[model samples]
Target: MRNKIFQKLKQGYSHLGLGDDILQAHAEGLVATGLVTDENIDNVVNTQKSFLESLQKANDARATSAATRAKEAARKEFEDAAKAAADEKARKEKEEREHKEKEKEMPDWYKTEKAASDKTIRELLDSIKTMKEGYDTMKDENDRFKVEKAVTERKNLIISKAKELGIPQYRIDEGFAIADDADEAKIGEYLTKVANNTKAQVLPGNRDMFPLADKQPSVENIKSIVDKLCPK
Candidate 1:
């Protein structure tokens, strides 16, 4: 069947080259080696179409594979990114919890140091107040003692200071008598007054220091002794 189609195709081409023969005899048998023929052209067209269809099918499969691989990679990347985000959030939350716990912690030193500092300040203030009270009390006692000594005895120190200033001891005694109130607590007032009035520096036995008697002197008696000793 292929030979019959080849013979017909060759005869058709030979007839195309006839010049003046209205119906000349065609040398169509030579079509078997002719370069131009319908059957061979159609076969080449079919073969090229088949080859193009194969190449297109192969390209379609390669495109599908590339798309599938791209999709799988994209899916894996998205999953990894989600896990990283979750891990980061969890880490931040854990750190915040730890920070809160640290904030709540307290040690013994923190409590005791503050307590000791407060106590020391309080003690120092109390000690300062006590020392001020003691100093004020001592000042009052010392002033009272001075008044009592001047009233109760001839201050040998005063007499000595008076003699250095060329003042007589009698004048010193008279000055002291003027200042003395002769309170009963001062036991030596009367005897000192008597000794000053008599100008007798020495007296007998234990009475030389003007000892207290069993009874306190009356105000009038004390006043009378003072008037005689000073006269003013």
Candidate 2:
């Protein structure tokens, strides 16, 4: 029975990575001290194996707990990273949306200015069309008189424009007679060409520059001559 207990203890200690030689030496010392006997040898072996098993169970539980903690930490890190990426994407999208919205909006001043410009153009076009229609529908003597009056008004406007451009009255009348069938735009073009041609012939200074020998120069005329000689 003692041999059987020793063999069982050796097997249990060996399975727990304790060498047989060490176990044998320990058992011998216990026996020499009279600590182990045939009556208690089996109980001693059982107690030692139970202690070793408990130690192994404790080590395994510690390993499992460490693995669980590491996994939780990794999962939390991944979730945080994913949340940060999502937040960045949302922020960029919001900025882009606001930028597009800003681009789509026009200023009140620009809108008002454009509306006014469009209205003015429409009114001008309508006025021109109405004038053309009235001219085309002439029938009676009164309608002919209205047509003549309109023609006279247009001629007067052309004469005024030509005078503004420094064109002589006789030249303006001659040009009108030559382009009597032409529209106002054509007449304007002719006047512009004439004005450009006559620019080189225009002399500098006023009539005071060529005063008659009999006429004495006034103070204003003398000041004008001094201004030309030594301009401010």
Candidate 3:
């Protein structure tokens, strides 16, 4: 079958310059047997093959360009996201640093309270040293010596109690100066009054550095404080 078709195709080509009837017979034979028939069959096949190859090359180039564009776009997006994250981190760090700076700037109430506490601690230390010195020197039996010793001991007891109870030095000093003749129990009671009055004046949400109840000091409490101070 294939040989017949080839023979017809060759006959068609061979009769290209022959008489029209003979060429037509070969052409008709080729067409009937399903062989080559188009006048420009070779040129058209070559042209079509070249055209398809060019089309495939063009499509491949386009695909490569699209991939390059996608890669560039993804890189730019990642860079933008990274930059935004860094900026956000810097913003939060700045906020935290500013907040810490604000905290370092102490408020007026804190400053005042700190100063008072410092003064209280200082005065208490000094009074303790002076009282210990006086106590070491009280050896004479004279009335003057006895009175001086009694006064020093009493003041020492008051100072020690105030220091132990976290009472401010100012209140202790003021109470002693005005009511030095008061008994130890009465002195404690008076100090308690001063502490309560001071607490009443304190602003809401502010804690008192030296807090004391309004209740009067009991004899037992006074005795305990005295024993601790003078120690048998």
Candidate 4:
């Protein structure tokens, strides 16, 4: 539309031999002949200016709307991509968890019994090592009864050591055994872990207060302690 209007204006201008004076004289001639008036020329100029302003405003609004629409489309595409990525991650994690659960649920003779025995072996090993170390450290006393006191003292020392190692739960009393049907290897590994956890250092003379056996002294013999304190 602008191109067409500009072409028309050029045509009119060229007809006047590109001379501003000729254009002005021609316009005045029309007014003198009563064909046009000054008020009519002024009104036409003002109307043309207002129409051009409105056209420019409409063009600006159209450009802004196109830009906004493009941004919205791009944002939606990115959002879809992110959602798909999250869904894939969640699915993989769920599949892995389900596979692990299936593995755990499948039980067998070797798995169950061996695991239990292993547990028993671990506890026994740690307890025996602790008992032996504590027994060797005690000073000799004249009375045979003092042997009993010394053994009990040793067990208490081991308990304290276990507690210090951050494994108070793993600390074995005089008598603790895995279930009869426990897996030997698993039980052994557990006992080893317990022993490792219980292998802790302590300050001197505090062993007496934290006795391994409370109701009965851990002295003289483990069999006696087990029978009296923890028959199981």
Best by lDDT: 2
lDDT tens readout by residue for model 2, 77-158: 9999999999999999999999778756978887788779999999999999999788777646678899899888887878
lDDT of 4 by residue, 24-103 (tens): 44444444555334446544333344444554467678889999999999999999999999999999999999988876
RMSD in Å for model 2: 29.6
Give the clashing pairs for model 1: none
Q: What is each predicted model's overall lDDT from 0 to 1?
A: 0.55, 0.70, 0.62, 0.55
What is the C-alpha lDDT profile of model 3 across 1-232, one tens digit per residue? 3344344444434323334454345445544655453555444233334443454567678889999999999999999999999999999999999977876798988878987999999999999999977876664445678799898898788787666565655556676443767887887786666656654444232334223346444565455444443344
1 or 2: which has the higher lDDT?
2
TM-score of each: 0.29, 0.33, 0.30, 0.30
Which candidate has the top score in TM-score?
2
- Candidate 2 pairs with clashing backbones: none
Worst 10 residues of 1 by lDDT: 18-27
Over 4 Å off, model 1: 1-39, 107-232
Evaluation by lDDT, superior candidate among 2 and 3: 2
| lDDT per residue as tens, model 1, 82-170 | 99999999999999999778655857787678679999999999999999999999999999999888744555544544444443345
Residue 222, model 3, lDDT: 56
Ranking by TM-score: 2, 4, 3, 1
Rate residue 140 of model 2 by lDDT.
62
Task: List where candidate 4 sits over 4 angstroms from the true fold.
Answer: 1-46, 108-232
